[model samples]
Target: MDRAQRLAYNQPTWLDTVAAWLLALLWILPLAYAVWTAFHPTEYSTRFTLLAPLTLDNFSRAWEAAPFARYFLNTALLVAMILAVQLVLATLAAYAFARYEFRGKNVAFALVLVQLMIMPDILLVENYKTMSQLGLVDTLVAIGLPYFASAFAIFLLRQTFLGIPKELDEAARVEGATAMQTLWRVYVPLARPVYTAFALVSVSFHWNNFLWPLIVTNSVKARPLTVGLQVFSSVDQGVDWSIITAATLMTSAPLLIGFLLFQRQFVQSFMRAGIK
Candidate 1:
């Protein structure tokens, strides 16, 4: 190559590199601080001395201070229940939108799409009233009831279903497959990546959900880890950074570990779903 071309090629992209590193640092600073505070003594929480003493007492105390085991169970059940209902409802709705031609089909889809513009938090009052009337207040079922039908999930799946070739559906039908069978064998299998991506998004959102859960649940019986952490941190004894950070880490550990372990699959699923 010419000298000028070589010089141009060898020039460093310092700006982009610095910008990326800066953003990454900003993103991880809270997590890094949490780890630092959670592991060290309370006196060192605001200090960054490298030789600070580390202890596991905070974790022990935090665990003993709350019903974390029950909280964990409640969060797990909530995420699973919401995900199952969302998948089933979204799949059925998406299938209808994708394959069926009916009266008011476009209008119905328009209504579904309209939900995407509306924030779920905006309907909290109505949702609370509905739950109250149903006598499901202060229960896990109440927390998950409003989210059983996810517009975003339905929209994503419907778009994916639309991208699927009609030939496969016809082939399945020619082989005597019913509509449900065709959907199961042809569409569902092909849409696995989309499902995975949606599952990840749904689980992460609901796992970290706080406001709705706080409003709907009045006791530890239905409170998720997030609410439990808040309650544990705001104690009458006053906030101790060490104990609070330790509890924060404990509550967030599952999601962090899960993301670290399945990050590759998560990215790949999103890529495939995006392509479809």
Candidate 2:
């Protein structure tokens, strides 16, 4: 290695190793506790013993206590709709900004960048007012509408598109391919890693989104799992740690299982995307 590289990337010291282990323990402690509580009887929740009996009754009780099936359906639909719309819009917008020259293009891109700086939570009241005016409140569409246009996705895709070679675009045009066809068959295929990376972020964010969905939706038909879980854990239902933890696990299991299954692909997508 070069002198600069050797100096800048020294091996971890003993203290660094200790700190890393401690942080990992801190992160896993809660999940471990939740797993233990969810599988064991309520009485054994606080007491950790090797002889503690395991049961699926907690999961059953949690399921019966709420309309989780509807919540799951609603959550699934909401996530899919948002992801689909965001991908379409982001792709078109990114292509235009990256490949075409137009009046005030820099100013328009600056506005999009401004959106990246503004936090979505800051617009909650305004968003609610708009949704209310459109009579979209209390519907799945209302929850997904505000997120249909994603600035981050546009920026990411645009950067990826810009990094692609112009020779590819010229070659496709030489073959008599139109603009849309070139985008579909050339740029889109080349940017698959970036799309995969962005899709992961969008899906995870929308899946766990709570405050906005909770504010916009009331009925079970529109409520996502996070909102449903909150209502399930409310005092009106009485506290049962085992059941609550089980419900938590149930709601989080899809994300956890998805990660476990796609961990390699996820890492590879991000790495390739960053390189592009």
Candidate 3:
């Protein structure tokens, strides 16, 4: 290409780069401030100064002020339970949708896809009513039962399954493997990358979910870290920025550390999952 055409293309590329950086900075500003305020004293929260003293007192106070240990355990259990069930259900459902040609299969798959367009929050009232009827209200099961069957997970896994070659499935069956055995030894093993990617997304989402958990859980026993953080930040006296920021950091530290440690694998999984 001539210099003039090359310059024209490079100009838009440069502009896109600048715009991306600007958006990234805007996104990171609040997190940067939270890190700053969490480590510094209350007086330095709003006032930015290089010589401000750092301390761990805010974290200690926040920890002592709430049942964060319980909240952490609750959140961990909730995420683990949801992820486990989702993986099992999604794997089975996706395999059926991808490989089986049963009656009404198209209609059933269409209904599943419909859920991708509907918002989960819109079903909160119905879910709550069902939970009440089941006598599971105000329990961790109630908070998680509504989300055990994830439409997105089913869809992603189905797409990944569909991309797998039929030769592998036939080979497994030719070796006298039952249908379930073929699925277990062939499809499930091949879809590991997609499974990992979906697990990360699921864990991150449930860890940060606040509204439904807040509504379903009434006490500290079932309250996740998000709700606990909310209660800790809202007291009768006033908002304590330093303590709140420290608590926020403490609550988010696990996810942050996990992402930082596995970001390369995370990106690779997503890329492989997206190939189909």
Candidate 4:
């Protein structure tokens, strides 16, 4: 009601704007450091100079020093293998959970909900044990096997499927469409946004995943980028900051590029596919 109270209510403060910029700066500080160190020579890594001679030599050294090509290939194969199987399995399970009527359905879905709450790290021991028993240790299959059944994917797709009009399902069935045909033609296409969102989450998580891959892998043959980075930056090698930073950037470049390119689609997909 007073002038001071009205001004405070009607206008934003400079302090809030300053705080937002400060937080943004803090968030990007590490990435800024990485870029500076990776692009400059070792001598200039710590010493920030406007005239620091930038060079590609660090990246060249990084690539030649380790089996990065093999690590990249393994990581690509692992993520693709995991995503392919997850989409197939998640779609089917989500369709059934959304549309089918069966005994123990609610209980089964409840179990999945519980699984979503439990951290995958807790299952590391059992998963490793199972993989060992199956003789899949130290393989791409081992790294991706446990994550193939994604509770989060199933839940997201199921929610999307539930929101679809049931009349469309009836119309499809009234035609010559079988149940499988109905699912492929109707549900899958409708839930594409949710699929996109889940795929992004899954890929990013597994791309950065470290401990499980580290434990299961013994050599570069099966090691992903995260594990490869750890081995590349081993303490045994006298720390070369430029080369180490270059290697780190190289490993994470795919994800950074992907997020940059698809950022709009990624945000829209999440918004559109969010629970109604």
Off by over 4 Å in 1: 1-12
* Global fold similarity of model 4 (TM-score): 0.92
In model 3, how large is the Cα lDDT of residue 46?
Answer: 98
lDDT of 1 by residue, 1-276 (tens): 665665688853656579989999998999999999999998999999978998999999999999999999999999999999999999999999999999999999999999999999999999999999999999999999999999999999999999999999889889999999999889999999999999999999999999999999999899999999886666788789898899999998999999999999999999999944
Over the stretch 1-276, how does candidate 3's per-residue lDDT look in tens digits? 665786887755566689999999998999999999999999999999899999999999999999999999999999999999999999999999999999999999999999989998998898888999999987889889988999999999999899999999889878999999999888998999999999989999999999999888789989999999886656999899999999999999999999999999999998988843
Q: Tell me the TM-score of each prediction against the true structure.
A: 0.94, 0.94, 0.94, 0.92
* lDDT scores in order: 0.93, 0.93, 0.92, 0.91
Residue-level lDDT tens digits of model 2 in 149-253: 999999999999999999988999999999999999999999999999988999999999999998999788899999999865677756889988999999999
Candidate 4 collision pairs: none
For each candidate in turn, give its C-alpha RMSD to the true structure in angstroms.
3.3, 2.2, 2.4, 3.1
lDDT of 2 at 248: 95
Residue 59 displacement (Å), model 4:
0.3
Better of 3 and 4 by lDDT: 3
| Model 2 steric clash total | 0
Q: Cα miss at 259, model 3 (Å)? A: 0.8
Shift of residue 21 alpha carbon in model 4, Å: 2.5
Which candidate, 1 or 4, would have the higher TM-score against the true structure?
1
